[model samples]
Target: MPKQLIIRGVPDAIARDGWWLASDATLPQHEPPSPTFPILGEAMKRRMPWIASVVFLVALGDLLFWGYVPGVSLVIFAWAIFAVACASRPPKRRVIAPALLLVLASLPMVEHAQLLSFGFLTAGLLVSVAWLRIAPSRGVEVLGAAALRLSASLPVAGVKGVLNCARAVSHERANGALPAWFSAGYLMRNWAFPIGGSLVLTVLLVNANPVFERAIVQAFQIDIDLFSLMRRVLLWVGLGLLVWPFLIVQAPKAAMVVTPPKTGIKLGLNAGSVLRALVMFNLFLAVQSAMDVSILFGGASLPDGMSHASYAHRGAYPLLITAMLAGAFALAARPFLAEHRALKPLVLLWLAQNVLLTGSAAMRLELYIDVYGLTYLRIYALIWMGLVALGLIMVAWQVLRECSARWLLIRSAIWGAGALYVCAFINFAGLIAADILTRATDPTVETQTDWHYLCSLGPAASKSIAQGTWPKLQIATPFWATNCLNPQPVAMNWREWDFRTGRINGYLAVDAKMRAVRDEDPVGR
Candidate 1:
């Protein structure tokens, strides 16, 4: 007898002869075990389930792993999953935007009580199957058809968008048209390939233990994790990519009916003002630097040195939030008051401030040139204070654009975060490079292109980090970058110097803990 399931209040044949009702499910007798989509009853029965399983597994694993949770949620999750499977015989769940959103929103809380995951899993499965109407991406022609479907449903949208998508896809396939996400001409055509690959990459990341930790932190904003930040950025970028094609392909048609960008700022003239604005920015930095000094010495005014989720805390932060208020109020209240030009002097003041801040760090670095051995200090505390101050000052003149934009998830935060990410990545790379170059012994370094390379199931990499002598080929290095975050680069840098000078053995990024492992000989000598 065929395996059966009650998909819709009735018994249905699920799989047979090694065939699955869906791709992932297979008959016990089939050459390979097959899986069931559980949403599609009959349509899925006739097709080979390989692709369905692949897509289903991505969504299902997340579902099962997340556990059972339901509400309006289960229905939505099931719909998304079904929509993906039906997109093709081995159809994918990549296009189920709603289910994707549900997964994102459904993560367990900080304490890790996963009742929420269970709710999400069930809700996710049900909800994923509900979006049968959006229609999957085909060629531009199909996309254009989908556009018409979307427009007919919208009072604001017209048929022009549908026509434009059709034309663009045709022109691009023939003469090569460019999509907006591209910095140059014709960068992306098929969103499916990238989106599909991104899902795969995300799964690999999900398996990595540290990557999981980072994902948890980003969802909760509980702590600083480099891989977590990197994952969030990539996830957003991928989401942006998925959204961009759909939006841009519809742009020309959409532009015909929509309001244009605001004209108050004036793009060309605004370019020149950017320099002056930057000067004011430096002044803002100065105020913050001075504020930090006064707070640290004048008396504890606020949480100046530690991280804060917001400005409510009454800490004399490295940033001077109050100082920028005067300039901001004037800029906003009266743009033409012509009274605001004095903001220039503050620009010079901020430049002076950063000079002091950088000098202070440099001075300390010099003190520890070889052996001062300083403890941890938040290096970018000053940089952030300065940038926030500058953006705040620029907001005063009506020239700062989005400096005062509302704080919205994945929007306002993403901008500041993108900048911070660059800073963090550069900081990490620089420190890691320095550690490896100067270390007393060679360490295991995983330079797998991007940071996400480490987010996967694998044998431990750090077990072999920082052992053996220079001029020797074999050594162990740290598996996860987190392990080396504190003791790295400086320790690594010094040891390598020792090795090159014939004072010790090898070159791998090592920490203070590896001091004894710096040499090749059994003796300490």
Candidate 2:
């Protein structure tokens, strides 16, 4: 029979032979078995597929495509999800969850507006997950592990259950043990086929699309192609993800065992990457707002839904700053993922993409100050957003590629996600405030409440004017850019407005002061 005795605060262990058989203190602490009570990180990693499925499924459901866009999106989203899961090399049995999710997501939705949105949401989620799984090289793995150690030592993940397993794999490698990729054929087996196939497919598919145009342009010296430009930006972003490789000199196999590290990846925790990424990400979001960038890279142009605010200047710039600053002040405290950290790797790429886009825009603006000079939410805005998205993906890719090195992906994902969600929450609040101010026709919501509110409403107000229905005035006078006195700024309405150097085409009226500011900086326009 098992023996148990309570001694004041603690329980007594087994005793025999007429005496207390005191166990050596050195013997491992009496703790839960490793199998039954598995480490938290591993458990979360196991559930990533399910979480991915849910996100994808919900997005697919939101697409709202019926007669308007042709509901082929459901099939496409399912295929994408399945393809991503397969690419992830999910544990043999894990495939079921994604498969079931794909089927469930196709459940018919009655709303017309929801179809396209759901489709987009689903596709984005699947693509993100697919991007998340790619593994970095072994050398990078070492650096990644070190970063993990340092990240953990900082007060980031413990509270939220984010740090431990959020960006799980390479984080362990950060300390010491090499992942499967370190083995001779591991690289070829793990990535070669996928990388090669993806490269060919992306090139072929993009080329096949009528709207998918690529051009070589003069930038500094060497002629730069679109692909090359994107690659350059992403390469630097990848480099930035290698934080703290030097800090953790060695790592033990036992995870959740925190150790101290002196240094970390110095590049502002991928906040720079976020700035770069936001250049494109904000643009990507903008396209959905406008009817450009196509709903699918698969085709040309997708329809825009109800959400009207384009995060052009205020959104992208603020987001970029936040992403960059988050590295030190905010980045340290959150889990490696919990979200914002998810974009850590693409810091350089994002910057480059933005630079390339801005450069391209400047070139166009130089020719026609009145038409092209002003910031417009057209193809260029989409391009900017694409740059940001691409940069972010590249950063995510860097994390995945180097997953063997830093193990930051799984752990950081949680914190990165959390940060992003928090940002989303902040956005929602601002959106509500803007809605209130739009109807209030007063300064209460704009000034007394969130100053950021005006940024979220500009595009919506522009659309209302474009449709010839002046939205119910929030203010009779120009309290902010979104007021009745002035038309939406190019920063807000530039995308959809037909533009040229001399003429302004959309709903908003153009002026000398605004046009001068818009037209002045030809180089940066």
Candidate 3:
């Protein structure tokens, strides 16, 4: 017999293959069937209002506080999460973790480049909290579920919520009593023809007589910018659309779907094959590590054909990419090879070597920067290398503990993305210029400064470039040619303000003014 459910006081046939009846149902008055998904039906019902309220409250606070004080916005966001915790009534311990992370991650929003990083980290936390509220005891699955929910929620939830609302409205209109204003047929019958006729008559009369058209234009000569009006409407509507689903419903539950294995392979790999691969991979990494240690660290001179800086620069990027691949392979392959006792130690040892390799990559990049001078990419590469190293360590821990590789990956990806996003907003050109200028003043240090690169750091470094005295006149020419010193000022609202831009513009304005005064009065200088 097909699975049967009483939907809307009638027995409905639900398909046998895990298909569910999604209709509204009423149980007996004496005792209702306990919710199969209590986290969704009950926990969310209790917590969603709080979550939604906090979301709007934070938005309001952002409007009021952001860019006014660099630190204040972070505090307000934290408190908004706190208020959410109180309203949801989750345990203090559970609420504290995500709340703390949100506040800390939000600190970087004071800088512009960190916005994507902040979005990813905060999205992860919000998803995690929503999952925890529904199913707090799922252990390792919580992290995976949170990852799944976050990945799914962004693109799927809003559309689903919209459909849900439409369905609700349709059902209510069809089955329940409706007010006259909401009845579509009644409205069309009563008002549609009259409104249409009025508009038609008005257009015809305006075209028929020049005098009437002039009178109408003068009477309705209000200053209305349609573009501005449309933009405001879209802004609030877009925000509402983005947040509506989250407010009305809970995120996907851990139970809604099964978590797949890291590799997704059901069949076993041969113990011999895995062992052979690990051994070969380890030997290859060993050779590379040995070479790096010898040439880069041991003071061994490079071959005549290659300069040390050139050799170092070539490997800096590729080696880090290699280490990242190694971490990924180890995570994916470890679960399959767990039966082999020897593979575990070898895997840990391999990851440790990759960490060392990452360190070597960082050293090489530093050497490259020392020779070529700093650019934004070089500085960010160093930061990324650090995160890659940390990720490798986490991968090793996952193997040692036999924890879920998926969990390790999810957490690592969150942090790595956050790091890169945060790095994006840094004023690298200004920083490089400042550092180079400081170093050039020193008589002891010997290094080439790339003034051309400094000038390319955009208007942010305008002040440093305009005022700096350089060794090469060629480098100084571009600064004058570009007129970077007096780039037009842009007025930023509180939402768009950030530390880097604020400081850059502030310094540039002051320095440009000073330069102007000094030029006008050389004797005073």
Candidate 4:
């Protein structure tokens, strides 16, 4: 009985020891295993497909864009591919919808690759990337932040990509032996020597005999443009850097922290300060407005020494700056508007004056344009003035409704973007050309149109130039006609061909045929 009890007790003792060993109280604690290469660790392994896609896209970009001017279709397709690749799995409809809109915005580039079109495309890309990565509820808030992050990432993305790739290869090597051909040591030893030696021997043989050199040249038939090669390589590097950030899509670790507003700080801005500023600002602006009304709208003659052109030129841009400054002051004074009843009305009056001031600036620009003829810059100025006027009105609305700064920012961005989007598609070059041509043809107009400036607007203005009924002696088959109508060194491939270029080409062909028929039939001329 004693022996049996001892055996049972021994089993019980063993069980108790095992339970204690496995229990939290007795278990030995251990830290997680450290990653050999943190950048190319398990998390990065899951993202291998993304990195691979980036590499593929970079190569595709080279194939599509290298040695060519990319068309709108190519631009859209490339951006779509990038956007799709970087998008989260099972893409949300909200995200897809906006991305599609952005991609479609590239359509304007199909007509003519203007700076406005380029800007829209660039903004679209940045916004798309931002949406994919951050998915901010409001785009206006994140747009600047995303742009800043992207700019910061661009410098280091390439180097980081290279290091990650190297680590990935090493990681794979550690997992198992790679094929001999794929191994770096194998490549350096077996492939490099033979290729290098063969090149050296081939060069020696070529120089040794003219017949050998001719044979080598004929057999190989390799023609390399050094400049072209350099350009392609640079494109690869630049494009790789640009695309890598979208692939990684690292969100900031923490939300942007806003510092709490200080209670004790006073910057001398109060109801009184705002009232004083508004009073003085209104008086100053009123004086300017009275002068503008007299000179521009009232058609009063200029002062003794000031020509109309001089007056218009001097005030056009400065008044615009002044209006912008007035808008800024109004925005800054919003906090004080509710403090004083008079402040709100005064602010509205100020904004109203600013709008009128913006209009006067526009009139000034118009007068200048009337004298000097329209150009791209003047068109932009006109558009900007319109925006400024609208913005001032929105500022007044904000003050009246007590709208948040965010509300104002979002609407302002929308208006500005909408205006730019519209401008992107408009044929401003053609408009400028037509306007200048119309003004030049007027019998009473003294200023001569700058034909060289018109020509510099490129093929977009070609149609207007070709269709214009010029004075008989003014221009007889202008030399710029051939240059604009038949742009030399035509697009090398469809990737470079745009709708605008194609239309121009088609028109040229038709025009040539018509001219030929007309030449044959003297009565038609």
Point out where model 1 deviates above 4 Å. Answer: 1-55, 58-319, 324-332, 335-377, 396-415, 427-525
RMSD in order of candidates: 25.1, 29.3, 14.0, 9.9
lDDT of 4 by residue, 1-525 (tens): 455434434467676667665546555467898644444446356767867776787788877877667675467554755565455423442466556856666777776676777777766666566556554454444555755676588679767977877787777667643444555787898889899999999899889999998887898888999998898888888877777766665544444332324577556888999999899989998999998888776878888999888898999999899999989888778877778889998999999999998998888888888788888888889999999999999989988888778778879989998898887778787788777667766778887767678778777776666565422235433575556533332343777777777776677667667667876985964
Best candidate, TM-score: 4
Name the lDDT value of residue 206 in candidate 1. 72
lDDT of 2: 0.39
lDDT of 1 by residue, 447-496 (tens): 22222332221111121223312223343334674443222332222111
Give the per-residue lDDT digits (tens) of candidate 2, residues 249-325. 13323334333254765545444544454556656534433332232123443236422123133243443343334
Candidate 1 structure, TM-score to reference: 0.27
TM-score, model 2 to reference? 0.22
Q: What is the lDDT of residue 262 in candidate 2?
A: 43
Sorting all predicted structures by TM-score, with the top scorer first, yields 4, 3, 1, 2
Instruction: Give the winner by lDDT: 3 or 4.
Output: 4
Native-referenced Cα lDDT, model 1: 0.38
* Per-candidate count of clashing residue pairs (backbone under 3 Å): 76, 94, 0, 0
Q: What is the model-wide C-alpha lDDT for candidate 4?
A: 0.73
Error of 2 at 378 (Å): 29
For lDDT, candidate 1 versus 3, the one ahead is 3
